[model samples]
Target: MNLKLVVMVFAGALLVSGCSTSKEEMLPAGDHSMLELWNGAEGGGSTARQAAAARESLRRPLTGSERQVDAQGDRSYSRTQEREITQQFPRLPNPDMVMYLYPHLAGGNTPVPGYSTVFPFYSQTQYAMPGERTEAL
Candidate 1:
């Protein structure tokens, strides 16, 4: 009985999935011109003028407080700015190892200029977990 029910359910699922794809879906409807589709029933010059008008309509003169906030907002944010109170998970320092290589020839004896490159000491970088000892030894 259980085997019969399982076989029936599997056959039903297969039938439903197979019937989902129709002959009409497999065939393309009509040939559409690339230029006709790109223009999208509108002239390029009229579309550009409409876009400029929309932009002008969306913009307005800033208020006194908004102007002040706008002036202050520019200097307010910094990527390098450190927050003192938000040190829940302090970063463990990953010291970079700089190596200076002398000029050497390549496979075809191509002259390679002397340059300095930096690489981390550890193969995989690790972060210090919260409340872990991260101080320098």
Candidate 2:
């Protein structure tokens, strides 16, 4: 009971400290004017230069010769079709193992006929890397 009271008191103190809003001055006030600070010996930030460059780029349009790519119908790069992409990266084949179950009744009452079922050799399907030989040597 005494320990419980101590814990409650500590929690209350922590809660009160957290709830208290202290706006104490960290550093003494500086004795400098805005004009003096602006015209200091050291150079200011490059934001002004960056803003100017952005403004200049927006003002003028790039010439066709200066552009990286010409928007003509004839493109330099060839686009691969879905069929071509599949052919380029063919899927690795997982051999299927066929199993046969002898003729037997599935349930005591039911007379189920025998059938053949196929199962993959691998647990999960696997894919071949691009340019990897998928065909048997």
> Per-residue lDDT for 1-137 in model 1, tens only?
99999999999999999878877698754455656544554444455556777999999899999999988897566434354323545767788999999999988879999999999877775766767888887
| True-vs-predicted CA distance for residue 69, candidate 2, Å | 38
Give each model's whole-structure lDDT.
0.75, 0.73
Error of 2 at 44 (Å): 89
Off by over 4 Å in 1: 1-86, 107-109
Candidate 1 has its poorest 10 consecutive residues by lDDT at 78-87
Q: Taking the tens digit of each residue's C-alpha lDDT, what string does model 2 give over 1-137?
A: 99999999999999998756645444444665656555552345544556687898889686977574565433545565865777777778989999998788766877878889999999887877788998899
Give the deviation of candidate 1 from the true structure as CA RMSD. 22.2
lDDT for predicted candidate 2 compared with the true structure: 0.73
Best by lDDT: 1
In the predicted model 1, the residue pairs found to clash are none
TM-scores of all predicted structures = 0.33, 0.36
lDDT, candidate 1, residue 83?
Answer: 49
Best by TM-score: 2
